[model samples]
Target: MSKVWMRTRGWVRRARPLVSLALVLAVLAACAPGPGSERADIKIGVQGPITGQWALEGLGFRNAVALLADEVNAQGGPLGDGRSIVLVEGDDRGDADEARRVAERLIAEGVIAVVGAYNSDATAASAPLYDEAGIIQITPSSTATDLTQHGYSRFFRVCYLDDRQGLFVASLMATELHVKRAALVHDGSLYARGLADWTQRYLQEQGIEVVYFGAVTPGQRDFTPVIQALDESGAEAVYFTAYWREAGLLVRQMREMGVDDVRFLAGDAVNNPEFAQIAGAEAAAGSLISTFPLPRDLQSPEAVAFSSAYEARYGEAPQSIYTLMAADGFRLLVDAMKETGSVDPADLAAHLHAIQDYPGISGPIEGYDEKGDRIGAGHVVYVVTEEGDFELFKP
Candidate 1:
């Protein structure tokens, strides 16, 4: 099914009473105290691919938002700013168009800022709407180099960008893992292609030859040819710059083809519990993947408390350590509102830009200049081990 069709059908099947309830709530929501409806607390919108291949990312973000909302409310709500804070949640279903539409709707609803749209393509599509509306966006997982290019002005990211992450992986392959020969395989999608190109250039610069650069489609059933090509090339490592679905197939196919020596490595897009679930525990057992650090020694008191509260409230463990980053992003906007003493979009943006070394849950996120690149080149790298799952590989 098409992305639109599937999204439409999914909503339609649940729309009957739910849609009516939504409409009624919208009408009744006029009395609610929010920046959009009132001059009080701001409405922070959160969006992500909640039900698609990258659902884990969205689920983690949603849980963090909910946790933060509760904590903020307990502290007398959304910085008060003379009013109450409200969270307006939306789903983008992993489609760029859906992400764009949802962002527009949130802006129309008067949100001061937005939290996510996990992948780069979705973030790239949704950011302009927030920019045109003069609302800020702090994505926990959008890593495309161009998402903030042209200074979307209103756009910000919690994670490192393409160059830092891609090059970090290249260095890991060259110096740490002893990987001399590699194949850069991607999903043929925007995020995959960008990361692949960056990693390829960096790998070559490090004197490591890329034996093959392969392309595969999302949801492609079998990866026999792709795996066969890598096996034939005798590459020691296969670097997959795609999401989990294709990564699962490629890893399994490599194992089935009797290519056990070829180590499979992936980027953050494929780093999740679901990868092991779909890719099978044994096939995924010895794989190597890169992701954010564990942050077990968080310096911020709020971050430490939030971690405990999250585990207690959710029961299940949180994926996406970026979970805490999303909450901190929301808090930063509210803090900006308080610091500026006005909800004027420009004033809020100014405050965010002036921020320095603000400790957040995922770590510290420093605001950017017109270029939107992180000032500090401090991206930590990881490796998936048979025993440790994914442990910090490079600092």
Candidate 2:
């Protein structure tokens, strides 16, 4: 054999064993489980506006869910099985059409559960999709009463229904404000219309006359016609059942239009920091908002801890009560998962329904009724201070 040929043969012979050993090691490594390999990731969907006029509330929902996810993961996940929670975010832009698309996307992504679609319209649109897909949905702020009437066993909300809020508003107007005549206005959205209708019913029950029950196109800036209507109606109080932006604009316009004698009351949707900014401190001051307890007003240990954590992470306190409610929804889901030890939609739903007096960051959740409506949920009226802060209404 040639000298070069012999050298090549020797080299091949020497490398053969090394190559075989490398192959064996690679096979062993491939077969063996690595760190976190035994644990699977649990996917949860966080759906909301995220980028529209209600982006503040949507962003709060996302942030609160993310924070809760981080905390749960740090604690060895929901079942303490080393499985980590993976959050999938779907932004519906606070529109029903977009919410339908988001719902499909989240279902396709294989999310076991969802928390959001902050607007009632969005929630109503996406709820059917979730139900059909066997996914659990928990809304933090969608308060339309009809949502629970759909017979969707997997759907629930951490917040009270619009009917409850409406009753509270009507009682506040009758007992505290002593208004004999009220004007009702809505933004033509599901939440706004539902709240307005219920409020009108309760107000009439209280022997208060509803002089004007009207709808305003959402996102409209000028309210000259509505202000004129309010003036003509001779309403002692104006109850606005809509979001903060519209309520703020309407209130500001009313004050500027010399409609000063009318008391401006808003629904839970108006409990936002930007309300005062939009309406101006002078106009927003003394305005009553019927809503769940504000985060600043909550004094429970769980609430205090959540608020501190949220502030520390976000560099500011929660701007809306919905933020805390969003956190509560996430916690409720996790608690159900931990208690049931299963991610199956049916198990989670059943466990949620069975939950009683569950301590939540917002308050004690006294379980869900057969319709998935939150039981023992209550509302309180808050007055806007001159500094644009929400304080409990003593009167």
Candidate 3:
């Protein structure tokens, strides 16, 4: 009996290695990427100037994307497969070189889609990189028309084009403001130059003569020479296709220089609350800006809810309209992903192009045309109030 027991113990010890090998193989098969394997996290990238002059705009976009991602995750995430959305942020500092580098880094990080780089120049410079990678890039605020004209199917924007915005302002100046002549100034940047040219052209087409068309260095504070030119031109309206900083300086100087009789018009760049703060309430009052409608004025439940939620979360009302666009752009991407049941950027782009009249917080995203420009999307007319807030322009 003792001999039999020793033999049995040896047999069991010899079989232990074979049993352990079978268990290891089973575990390996389960862990490998194949049928019934767990899905990895889906990554979405948001790139912007988180530390530069335009950091507010970039941060606003990043915040909106975060909000959307959180909501999606809270709702059990995408595809109902336990797969979650992970947000990866890249700070481009609003520089072209940095933007390209950031774009490449995000691509390497395995982001399927990206939303960001607020400025037109940054977006224009970095778009080719994304196009080469075939990733979807939906800009929340880059409005330069040439961005779409490049035929990069991967690029799309929720904002209106620079030319369309300029034309909208020109139509208002001619039909509503009833101006016979207007003065125009550009910041010499691609966006401002293109906007100024288009607005000038539209004014000319409407028989409203452009009395003075000139350029100015963006960061320059002294606008006395430009104000003098406008004053000498006998223009009934003054349109400056520049940003908030220069717009504020120009408006303040014009007021001080006794050019208050003429209507001061500005572009979407001055649509922020900072514009009013910089220009002063009294000076900013009655100033008209071609912009997108504020969330409060949008009247959609989604818009209203978004405004309230954002204010609650951030402890302040959204100062820039780009936040709304960013949220909408993110929703479009996620909605596409959900609908197609795929995380592929190409799938998202196809669904985005096919999307028609997507009810958005900003407005109805009427889908993208062949040029990737928003179809049937236009700018809103806003006037500064005494409280230094945007009010829907009745006229």
TM-score of each: 0.85, 0.90, 0.89
Order the numbered candidates by TM-score, best leading.
Answer: 2, 3, 1
TM match of model 1 to true structure: 0.85
**What is the per-residue lDDT of model 2 for residues 165-284, given as tens digits with 9 covering 90 to 100?**
888888888887899999999988899999999999999999999999998998899999999999999999999998889889999998998899999999888888889999999999
Model 3, span 200-266: residue lDDT tens: 8899998999989998895898989988988899999988887888898888888988888889989
Highest-scoring model, lDDT = 2
- 1-395 in candidate 1: lDDT tens per residue? 11111110112223356468878667556545444444345567889877977776787788888777666666665545345556677789878899888998888777788888788888878888888888888887777776766667777777777777789889988888878899999887678888899999999999888999999988898888888899898899988988878787778777878899988889877766667766777788778777666545354787678778878888854566667667777777767876776766777777777888777777776666665455565556555556436566643
Candidate with best TM-score: 2
The TM-score of candidate 3 is 0.89
Model 1 CA lDDT for position 385: 57
A best-first ranking of the candidates according to their lDDT comes to 2, 3, 1
Compared with the true structure, the alpha-carbon lDDT of candidate 2 equals 0.87
Deviating ranges (above 4 Å) for candidate 2: 1-39
Evaluated against the true structure, the overall lDDT of model 3 is: 0.82
